[model samples]
Target: MPENVNYYHITPLVNDLERFFNKYRLLAVESKELGIKLETKDLATFKPFPNKIYVMGSLKLSRNRKAKGILIRKEGKPVLNYSVASLWEFERSPDRIERSKVIVDYTISPKEAIPKEYGNLFTDDFMLWEGFSGMGKGGGRPAVFEGKPLVLPSLIRITPDELEKEFLCRNLGGIWTPKHKASAENRITRLQTFGNTFFPMMSRQYFPISWGSWESFRLEGEKYPALEDAVEPNV
Candidate 1:
């Protein structure tokens, strides 16, 4: 097995229990209405649930106009003429519209962070250094290599505030290359401008396990609780 394949256990916060259950109930009701033949026992076991249909209440319906034309030859004295005509069509319309969208994921893990235990799997090229000891002044060496930080994959269960802070501090540097400095600055500005609203919007929604397929649910406005509230019922 690959060293990076670390299994993560995610638990939702306590406050979100009621809402999660409610959504599950709604899903069950909808499934029944569609005559999908869901097994209660399987659902109760927390098997993968089928993809639930959700209305993007935040998005407005869009209208599209379509037209068709046909070419025909008309009788002429010396040359043939072409005639074009338009076909009848209906006007398109938008559904619902909103300002933002919420993304819910069961698992949230760093795409690039490496786990400490898997240190051997990585080479010097992938390592990041910090905390320079000897530099400038006399003949001094460059920055020294420090131990690698532990990065592991886990379920999404952090508070928005914490995430925002971490995002801001992640790129702070004592000595940075031009590329690193620019990237850090961009991230800092983005977090400062949208940190509060951004983190909550990115919160992932948790659902009951079902034997079926996983489904996503969308709601109008930002009425749902933050992802931090989404906790497993038994937990």
Candidate 2:
């Protein structure tokens, strides 16, 4: 019942620019958990989803090295939701051979209580996760931030990138592309009540989908409802 689990991420930023980021960690505080690292590489080239986050520039961790995936949004959606852990077959799947990283909690990195006096109003780099079973070592009990709770470190790392070309072709709120022209699906029908994986992504020749009853389970589980706990924690 111990497959190395620890995850926690909270970056509430907005102004004060946290000194333009130069290394600010508050993870695990001293080892109760919060040790995330796994970027083994290759998850079928790319195209695996659950919210979404994949890119590489600087978060500190390099093993196989070949990273160049980028996805982020706010007025668009996505806050770090992509999952893989051998779909709960868990013997050890920090995404079990790639898809690993952890480093976030930049003392509330620009989460905005009212800061933005200048730049960084759309994304100064973001990442946060307390899921994918971040509190693994057992189950239930870990979930504390700003008061000191352990178990949190599956992976967290992101900083400084060219992420301002309009956050480049977003895909979290539905129909960012795949050529989604949106003649009038009502913005994909108001983004299907908070994104039901945008329902088969509307047939995806880019877009042409149609839905109704149960939105067809909205991309129903194969391992992505925030990863259903990337499995393996009977600890």
Candidate 3:
């Protein structure tokens, strides 16, 4: 019998957003195989989870940076769900140092990558991630807007002094201190989520199988789900 080795690369794209999400799904399955459970419920109603996980972010390589894949935390342990190299390769155990580096790089300057509509809302260093609920201690503010609740699936950057004011003025879904800023930000930077003040958010969606299930897995592997193969691939 021959070894089952697979090659991976980012896929070409006609639709950018569609491809990015496809990569996200692949990463989710890889996370599952690593024993990291998918959090399906709203993250707002419970005590804060100890890990600040980022489901998607840009990866910096020697040549250039590519916007794709990220690390997710489960039960207080960091798991390298997917990376640029994950499109074709599967690792039983990713290196701890690489995992730490991915988490750190995930929080770097994401200003340019932010959506145009969300521009005026944030002007400081920020990190974007899904599954954010502004409840619990140090979990930011309650996600309320115009007497209604909002679903926060993204993370933003702010300052400690501006925390209270931002929540009130920007109608932020919630505002709170980042428990691990000293390490994640390496400075006094606060994190926030989208609210309905400037660009209102839609209610959260409930998925029966969650966003990324092994039900979508393939045996031969996939191309990087990027619009371009220039950076890296993880489809």
Q: Give the best candidate by lDDT.
A: 3
For model 2, give the 10-residue run with minimal summed lDDT: 205-214
Writing each residue's lDDT as its tens digit, candidate 2 over 49-141 gives: 323332123112134332212111112211222221111011122332212112222122221121222111111121112221122221222
By TM-score, highest first, what's the ranking? 3, 2, 1
Best-fitting candidate, scored by TM-score: 3
TM-score of each model, in listed order:
0.16, 0.17, 0.20
Q: What does candidate 3's lDDT look like per residue over 73-171, in tens digits? A: 122222212221111111223331111111111111221222221101110111111111121111112222223433222322233354554334333
Ranking of all candidate structures by their lDDT, best first: 3, 2, 1
User: Candidate 2 regions off by >4 Å?
Assistant: 1-114, 117-144, 153-235
Task: Give the CA lDDT, 0 to 100, for residue 149 in model 2.
Answer: 34
Residue lDDT tens for model 1, 1-235? 2332221112111122112222211011011111122222211111121243211111111132111100011111211111111111111223221112222222112122222332011001111111111111111111111232322111122354555445443344311112233231122112222233211222223221111000111111122212222211220
Model 1: lDDT of residue 62: 18
lDDT of 3: 0.22
Tell me model 2's lDDT, rounded to 2 decimals.
0.21
